[model samples]
Target: MYKSQIKIISVIIIALFGFILFSQDLEANSMPSLDYSIELQHDGSGIVTEKRQMHLTEGTEVYIVFDQLEGSEITDVFVSDYDEPFTYQENWDINASREAKTGKYSLIPTDEGYEISWGIGEYGDHEYTVRYTISGMVRQLKDGQSMLWRLFQGRNNLPPKKFSITVTGPKYFDPELTKIWGFGYDGEIYLEDGQLVSWSNQPLTGRNHITVYMQFLDQPFQPTLSWDQTLAEQNHQALENNSYQNEDDTTDIVAVILLCSFLGIGVLIVILASIYTAKRNKAIRAANPLITGIKRTEMNEGKVYREIPYSEGNILDVAYLLQEHGKGDMEAYFNAFLLKWLKEGYIVQLNTNEANGDKLKLTVQLLDSNTPELEQQFFDILLSAADRYGVVDTSDVTRWAEKNYDKITELKASLPYESKRTLIDRGYLYNEDVYFLGNFRAEVTKSSYQGEDLYNRLIQFENYLNELLSLDRVNLQQQNINEDIIIWASLYNLVEPFVEKFQEVEPAYFVTHHFNYSNIYLLSLYSSGFSSGYDQAVTSHQTSMGSGGTTSFGGGGGSFGGGGGGVR
Candidate 1:
């Protein structure tokens, strides 16, 4: 009887070990899945509802966390097990260890996010559902409404098995002009059943986020055509009448006599004066023909080859040029300087690789020494702003701007004065201020002296470069730099050839990774017309979101969906 009992005990222990291993394997292979749906209205408000499911073993407790959304009021929180309601523990201590908990479930609030805990009574697998409502998700625009949805926040450890978001709106809503941006992941937006705009991602893992932006037009666009026969007839008659002219030949003999008498006296005076002046000029020219010819040549050259006296092949010059043209835009300024630096060999492109279908990575090195004072200053500022890794990536330009925001602001503030000083030194300006008096003149002229209108400055710079390079303005316009990439390349290509004509050969150096010249190229292109369109879009979007602006959902400091569960 003792031997049989030992045999049964051993078999039971073996079965328990096998069951434990199987449960561990199952937990490792499975993850929770989530689904979200948001219903929006035209008045800048919306509701967000979601459902999630996960599997757990018996006695294992799971915690569901919710991340707070910015500019949103969350309410109507509900949690349940499948279709059944689960009771929550009151007065639960969040600081207590997970193993110390004796309750079946608890909802505890924390600084980072809310935690919902549940103990599994008996489970091979289980599913839980959560739902919440978010108000003020949409922003009111002048003509319509806009919404920005951040799809990935508050997610940790729970690698989504599948995730989807659907946004439904009124029947008049159009999804064609919707804009979507994804970080660390890619997603697609499309119309569903003509009224809903849906965005979806599946099997997401490892910290990913997405943003969806949509603008709804207040009214549907309708084209109309109407022609007025009577108006056309009137226009034709007006054109015919204006095309004809009548000549008046009536003469006044006394007036003609007076006019001829004055004209003859003027001619006699001019002839006498011309003869006297010619004789004096002949004597002066005969005395110094070489000097006269040199003076004349200099005057003609000044008209034909008017050079922009300021330095052109450096970063500061580009900044000055940009400000002069009223561009004052930081990205365009950086892009212009980047082109100059690349051409002057201050920055060298070392290697290139395709990062993805739409992205390119370039390795670059910054050469030390031998740059202009201003260029070196700008270069050092950039070097100082490098990441902790001691290297700069082309993609980090925006980050660089953010990290050195104060310096950048100071640089922008001093740029106008520096630009004026450079111009004054070059004799472009007589002084800091040029004044014009009118009957109703008041205050200062901010546009010209204060660097307000950058577009005008750009035109002036363009004209200056055209004359300096002896380029045909008509031909340059015909090349259409905006549409022709070859022409665009050729225009900037002038920088290197011009510099090489004057500078010494030097080893090129600058450090960079994933630097794509196209980014800089596109930036320079903005100097033409694209920048205006970008500004308009940004302005419109900002105006729609109101003064405080629409906040990014997952960017808040508090935890909304940051807490998760672990298997025990």
Candidate 2:
């Protein structure tokens, strides 16, 4: 009805539309990116691999154009069929580190966009293949093998990626490859055979990804064998062919397996119970070690200890040992250390006062006395004992002081205990304990506390202003899934391979891929193992002594060590 009003409204509408368009363009251009990286460490044990997130936009694509995969043999390709927050990216770029004798892959752009020409052509002994496409995963088969495949709806949104894979292994056995599906971005798929697992949540975005993996073959021969030989060697049936088939033997074998399974479950229960008991305590490690000469922030000792327990005192204590090994200083490192050891229940607090009369004062407490040098000495002593007694190095005789010495030395050292007992022969925590552990190869000296001969306790003190006005309790949320169950799953995953990698029923391969989506991401432009892939001095580790080589096999074994290769 009114021309002026109508004209004004129209102008506003036009401006609003333009703003919306501009915002969308900005979002598309600067969206978070994912880089798909596959790392392979060459310790004869096998590949220790990982993936990465790269810088990307809605329409941007990265291609991994590798000219060579340098190792004694490409035993297995490290790929995961995970989805959301993590899907695999395609490899691109064609320059060789060495020669022009090798060329990059060819490309053919297509209709909807450019269809990446992948895994089709062979470049050389060195090759490039589209391991898997991240963005366009349209059809996931129903066999349920992808590590990124989800079973719950809210976990992740399917990004519709796809690939038709055809792998003909130099086979001793080949199972009819099955179709895997029913993927929940944050759930599991339970088949009569195996299951897929994950640890993240997602409503996957435009450039986000998920990953799935194939099975692995553990036959020592498969890495170099053509397929049939690998199968023949892997499918060895000595036990099946044995002449020991008494009905009694069948009964005995069944009985033995049952007994072992029951025993295993019992052990698992004990471990789970122990860990649960450990975590539920909600205790920060003993923080008897005091902070000296700091006047910045009034550090909540509990929070600081939970995150970084090592002291920055003038005295050279465990904190200094950590510094020697690259853990940061009192300002940076101790805080983090405390956070991990928070539930360990070992910290203590010293007295506090005011600095500027308005600010808070602080006193120094000494907690950890073990130094890095001490830990090494413990190891050295163990090796000397091993050499003297003629015990195999495999025994690691010096490392086993758990319930006994663990409580005496490590536990006491972890607290505000005055001194480690000097009586080594009477089992008092002493230089003798170190001597005994070092001699027997039993770890008498726990890692950080292995050496405590470094402090004079002449540390100074300072006043720190408390940052928080209120020392509120931190609300640490519990994971919904029983951590015990997850640990069981992870441990089994880390252990069950011997059986799976050796079984010879049909054509088969199994791959176990896990995503540790903690805030701890692979930070450096971090390439591993030097040349083609990446490897760094592993900053983190599995805590227990029982790592890779402790499994007991039934019969005699062949010499199975292989030479580790260098990057060309």
Candidate 3:
């Protein structure tokens, strides 16, 4: 009885082991096989042909996904079986409820690539041939044309049994000059009668894809300069006409001489008036202790001199203050604004734990609740979204800009329009209309402004800020007052006398002290009360497939089509 019981247990264990081995064999057989080929052209185009074979179970359906080449215009896509042709669609969602109805196969376009699904009637063996033409596959190098051909990066779900590629180009192409690199499988390339051919028959295990980089020996084709030559000839004729006019216009030349003399006299009068006004203002400022007190208080407190009756709410106000103080250094004023904000607790520096001597490795973060609306707009809409943790890291800002490009563009387009409307509503501008009598009468209108020179200067200041924001953070962070010192001096000429006096009082301290303090003030004001990064951050969150040319694929038991697939 004991021997019989042991025999029964042994038979059960043997049967279980056999079943596991059979299942593994079935999984291996289910993977699809691919055979691919391509023909190249000198004008950076290619015609690709692929033959695929897939094995399906009794109730399973197979979908073949193909990755479209980047920057290439694909056309003439065709899919066929041994007996009949397959129907295809472009840019179709695979998850959508659709049916081939009667056909054996159907092809659909996806964001990353294309998908081809076919029903296996008997679940034995199925074969399909796909063909397509791609234009602009070759990239232009400095001296010649190069092509980076990638395969097996996409459609990894359907593993290929054998893959082959043949590149046929111009006779001038030399295989010796062509360099190739393989990613997944080691492949061989040989020049056969002036044509470059490559093939691989290894199993794609522990590999992503294969990339072949080929540089042609021949120089890139260049068209003759017929249009440029014509343009040069036209420019020469214009110069000849100008020379002829110079010889003929004696009366016009005399009129020019008179105009120049009058202009020179006007310039001299303006310069004399400017010199007189400067001396007079200097005398007045020297006598007035109130103005002197304000400058002294700003230097001591490291904030905008609120006692001067200049608005301190917006960047425009800062520009007005600088202009009124006879200081043209926007950079200095901006630095002062930063310092003020820091003092007000709008922005705080978070110290890094990493040690780098006494040099501050600090990231700026918004802190206070009393940020001005304009500053809040800049902080929430621009700066905060740049860093993940609301810390203003320059590198993070660049990465954020790349990911949220649409938000950047929308802000750029809308800000100027909104500013214009605000200025108009504030009585800074009036609409001027002009009527033109053409084939059809029409009216053209534009904003006409009154003589508020400060308002115009404020507009220019805003333009400068926009230009700064548009720059990459690397360039923006490198900006310092010394680079544009001449422009700053002109802008701050009103405050130059006071600044000189302050410099004399503390000869070595003025430049470093003022600049550093001002920067802190500006940052604090800019980031105050803004927790969210960009105003459009919420709206910008959506699905994205990323930039690679590869598509992804997955198989669900019920339906063959769903999910995207691509090649690298």
Alpha carbon RMSD to native, model 3: 28.3
For residues 1-568, what per-residue lDDT tens digits would candidate 3 score against the true structure? 2335445655675466546544554343343566667677656667777676766553334564545444455567676666467665444343433233223445555586555555444445767676776666565544455554554442235455566666666454554444332223444555566665656646543233444444444544331111222322322232222221222332454446555645665575566556555654454444332222244234434222112222323433334233334442323433343344444545455555556442221244664577654445445543544455556543344345444545555644444455445545655434443222222222221223432443334334433443443455455445442312212322343223323333344334334543333343334333221212222232222211111111112110111111223221
Model 1, residue 221: distance off in Å is: 20
- Candidate 2 per-residue lDDT, tens place, 1-568, comes to 1234445655675466546544553222221212222221122222222222222222212222211112122222333313222222245333332222123222323222232221211212211222332221111112221111111111112122221111222232122222122211222221222222222233233222232222232321212212222222311221022111221322344346545645655575566556544543322122122122231122322222111122332211333333323322221222222221221223222223446343211111223456443323333322332334333121222222211232224422432222222222223223212112123211222222323222111111110102111222231112122212221121112112222221222112112212122110110011011111100001000111111111111111111111111111
Question: What shift in Å separates residue 357 of candidate 3 from its native position after superposition?
Answer: 59
Query: TM-scores across all candidates?
Result: 0.34, 0.19, 0.33
Off by over 4 Å in 1: 1-29, 41-45, 58-61, 87-107, 116-121, 139-146, 149-155, 170-172, 184-186, 194-202, 209-465, 468-568
- The residue-by-residue lDDT of candidate 1 on 1-568, one tens digit each, is 2335445655675466546544554334244666667766444445555566665543356655545444444455555666666666677654555455433466566665455666554454556665555555554434444454454432334455666567676454543344322222333444555444333344554344434444444423221211222322322232222211221212234335545645665575566556555655555444332221233334334332122322343335434544433444444444455555555545543333555544432233565667655545556544664455344444344434433444655665666667656644544432222222222111221223322223233344344444434434343333222212212223333433322221222112111312233444433442333233334334323322111123222221111123234333
Superpose all Cα atoms of candidate 2 onto the true structure and report the RMSD in Å to 1 decimal: 30.6
Supply candidate 3's per-residue lDDT for 500: 38
Give the TM-score comparing model 3 with the true structure, all chains together: 0.33
Q: TM-score: which candidate is best?
A: 1
Q: Evaluate all candidate structures by whole-model CA lDDT and list the values in order.
A: 0.43, 0.24, 0.42
